[model samples]
Target: MTDVVQNGQAKRVSNSAIFAGCAVFVAGMVGAAYASVPLYRLFCQVTGYNGTTQRVEQYSEKILDRTIQVTFDANISSGLNWEFKPARMVNPKIGETIQIEYTATNRSPRPTTGSAVFNVTPMEAGAYFNKVECFCFTEQTLQPGETVKMPVVFYVDPEIAKADETRNIKTITLSYTFYPSEPGKPVAALPEGNKAVDKKL
Candidate 1:
């Protein structure tokens, strides 16, 4: 009788342990689902070159020409407070690099953390995108009212000069949009089937 009681008690403990473990697993899964949707959305907004919002895709051949327009669009989805600025932009002839600066702020009442992703599509030009320095590609945490300056350096492939379609183009605007990022979450790819402006020749 004593042995049987002991065995029953051991079995009950084992069952309880299994139930607790399953419960934790389910909770984790639910949390993941909740966090994944927004991150995915951010990914799409950053990567998708859809023409609805502002984007950069062209450059003037005149190096001394400062006539290029720098466009800005603000995104606050991740509860992030931010700003972007042009540090310095050079209108290179054909084989020169362009550099720009961006600034971000944490306007939230509480501490917040996230990352910004950026994409540049040079319409009618084939330029290799390079990041000399930027805050958009990494995770950043800001205290209340804290602000930081970010920089990006990129060059337009001179080969674009060879294309007649890009020769007449007088403007290339570099645009940046901020997106929220979280660990263990999947970033969303740009929206599919949306009519994206054809920047490619």
Candidate 2:
């Protein structure tokens, strides 16, 4: 019965090995799934994929004489109780830095927080649109009936004028959509006896 005992032990060991291998594989897949989102965002930022624009701290000194019309669009996602819109349209020369404002008002009686997601139109133009400063980079919390004007400073990369695909393009549109921060989270009511702070737009 010694041979029988040895065969059973070998079988058990083989089954244990298979189970261990599957556990490791599953763990690896889970890790990869968790990492995919940030990785994809980084890839989009670098490549300007899907109309994702680039962020910069400063614009180049070279300003092209060519001018392009830039239109701004703002949207509020469903369930976000806020009014959002662009203040104006602008025509800026390539490589000229400009700042534009968007106003957001919290219409709900409760204090609400939102974060904006932005993109550029004519998808190929995204690679050429650069933002020096944008309020969309962070979350904004507004008191009840509060209004705030958020700004975005950006420029069209002068190099865009040299690209055959975008050289002839005369207009670009930047769009933003504000969504409630953390879906399903209850909005907190403004604290009693606290006056809403007046913020300059």
Candidate 3:
């Protein structure tokens, strides 16, 4: 009877240990699942994988003699009643900073808000496409029938002409998509009474 009691206690402890181990593993997996998205995004931003462009505060260090045709593309998510378009194209000397603009008009009778997400094409060249200033990542709200112009100042890094993966690339396309913002979300602080307009842009 003494030996049996000891075995039963040991068995219970073993079972408890197994359950605790499984619980810890599940918790870890759940945490990892939650972190995967931001981690992947950071990874993409760092490596310029999947056409994720780089954001820079200052102008390029140098400008190359060769010019590259940079094109613009715009898109609006469904349910957002807005007309969005970008200037067709511009040729800028490598590393030359230039500003291009996009126009957005709210067609709905009621006010609406939106946020823009952007990316670059020729995924390999994304690493060299840099934005000095952009209206993206900000909530934009528009009054009924309002039109506004948004600007993006950007430059192609001169390193594009030297990187083995991007050398010989002649064109890069930047694209944006606007999605409707959820109600009750914070609106961007615009100058009082600016209808879909940003003076800084």
Q: Give the TM-score of candidate 3.
A: 0.83
Candidate 3: global Cα-lDDT?
0.82
User: lDDT of model 1 at residue 34?
Assistant: 76
- Per-residue CA lDDT of candidate 3, range 58-150, in tens? 888788889999999999999999999887699999989999999999999999988877788899988888876677746788889988889
Candidate lDDT (C-alpha), each:
0.50, 0.82, 0.82
Tens-digit lDDT track of model 1 for 83-182: 4344544554443445655566677787666655444445333232323334454456666877766655454444444567655555555555665556
Clashing pairs in 2: none
Evaluated at residue 4, the lDDT of candidate 2 is 100
Q: Which stretches of candidate 1 lie over 4 Å from their true place?
A: 1-75, 83-90, 126-129, 183-201
Candidate 1, position 136, lDDT: 51
- In terms of lDDT, model 2 sits at 0.82
* Model 1 lDDT, residue 70, Cα: 35
Query: Which 10 consecutive positions of candidate 2 have the poorest summed lDDT?
Result: 186-195
Clashes of each: 6, 0, 0
Supply the TM-score for candidate 2: 0.88
Q: Any runs in candidate 2 off by more than 4 Å, and if so which?
A: 183-199
